[model samples]
Target: MLSAGPTPKVPLDSWEFVITTETGAEYRWSWSELMALPQETPRVDIHCVTRWSKLGTTWQGVSLDTLLDGIDTDAAYVLAHSYGGYTTNLPLDDLRGGRAWVAHTFEGGDLPAEHGGPARLLVPHLYFWKSAKWVRGLRLLSADQPGFWETAGYHDYGDPWREQRYQGD
Candidate 1:
């Protein structure tokens, strides 16, 4: 089990995942409600920034693009905030076009909390760290602001193929 911080105990019954933008826009998705939304099962190979890779894993959830449907935004980046103060940044392009998901299930079962149960961002193209665990919200920004790990010297845009693990790598 790899963890960058303590696992947050998210209350499944009372939690609501949210997506927001700078211009006073917000969408609240109750756990059950979001799960009822259109879901996709994508086979993703996750590469961790810590030098490990899990290949061809399956996940089921709502695609980021689908969640953003009908929402107009000119922002170029997003700060994905989680229930436990964890945050990661992704370019607007990264979260669109089926590149990411707000996943709630893994391997044909409800996602275990240890693996970010209720909802987590799944961005397969980038290092797993960019797939923020226990994700609760996404705040759009016009500027590319660094997230938690990025601010702590990890690469802002973690591309696994390029092995962009740390700042200045």
Candidate 2:
């Protein structure tokens, strides 16, 4: 479940992105890289399949609009590649809205590693799974694909508004 919150906005100026490998190697992302692509800071509400919802969340990250700025998206969908081969696919449109973000900072602090630090995909409009934690990269695809949980019976499109959770929801 997601956490319920009045959702406070905290200054994220000092939050530096940190990447830790399974072998314990740590790398810090430079501001140039963080801002290499166009980024958007949005005040959004998050809904987790776990059922906790946190409102008024302030997040900062590269927006799909910014990332696809000069490149042609050859695929009809995208694969959210994360640590441990965790991934989720979504139609191009789903990633377009200003609603989606690759958030690097949360609640005025660098996101904790336990909470997908370094970077995480924040799909505020969908169930949290759609927002892959510990995100690394995004792969464009020609067709829709399912990820680990999806193959295990979770809904393919985790839309929070529709309350899509388990199969046949």
Candidate 3:
């Protein structure tokens, strides 16, 4: 697994996932609460910007649609925040309609910390970097805000199929 920095170990008991709207309103879910939500096993092919591809990987987790249900917001963008201060941005639409999930299990087993154990954002359609590891929350924004990689010259919309890796790609 590729990481921008060292892996972080987050305890499950204190783990929490939050979604904050542009209006400052916050929605939260503890580990137990998250686990109780409806879960789905998605088998997808993931591609990395570095030219590596992993096909037919299975993951179990709550769908972003399920987690975002009942939320009221007009934001058009989202910034995913992770436990180790890692962040990534995506169009809000990309996260809905079963396009994404907060994955916690891989291949029928608990996800290891090095692989974003407790939870990670899974956006298989895009390059792997768009899937923020150790995801802690999502911040809704009215305007696009570059995250860790985006700010450093990575493409704002990292579509692997189109080879959108660097800013000019």
Q: Which RMSD does model 1 reach against the true structure?
A: 1.0
Where does model 2 exceed 4 Å of error? 1-31
From the highest lDDT down, the ranking of the candidates is 3, 1, 2
Quality of model 2 by C-alpha lDDT = 0.69
Candidate No. with top TM-score? 3
Count of steric clashes across candidates, in order: 0, 7, 0
lDDT of 1 at 161: 92
How accurate locally is residue 114 in candidate 1, as Cα lDDT from 0 to 100?
86
Whole-model Cα lDDT of every candidate shown, in order: 0.89, 0.69, 0.95
User: Against the hidden reference, what TM-scores do the models get?
Assistant: 0.96, 0.77, 0.99
TM-score of 1: 0.96
Cα lDDT tens digits for candidate 3, 1-169: 8999999999999999999999999999999999999999999999999899999999999999998899999999999999999999999999998989999999999999999988999999999999999999999999999999999999999999899999999
Candidate 1: residue 135 Cα off by (Å): 0.5
Best by lDDT: 3
**lDDT by residue (tens digit), candidate 1, 1-169:** 5667888888879888887886868988898888788989999899987788899999999999888998888888999999889889989899999999999989999888889877889999999989988999999899989999899998988999999999897
Q: Which stretches of candidate 1 lie over 4 Å from their true place?
A: none
Q: How far off is residue 157 in model 1, in Å?
A: 0.7
Candidate 3 global CA lDDT score? 0.95
Task: Return the clash pairs for model 1, or none.
Answer: none
Model 3 alpha-carbon drift over 4 Å, by segment: none
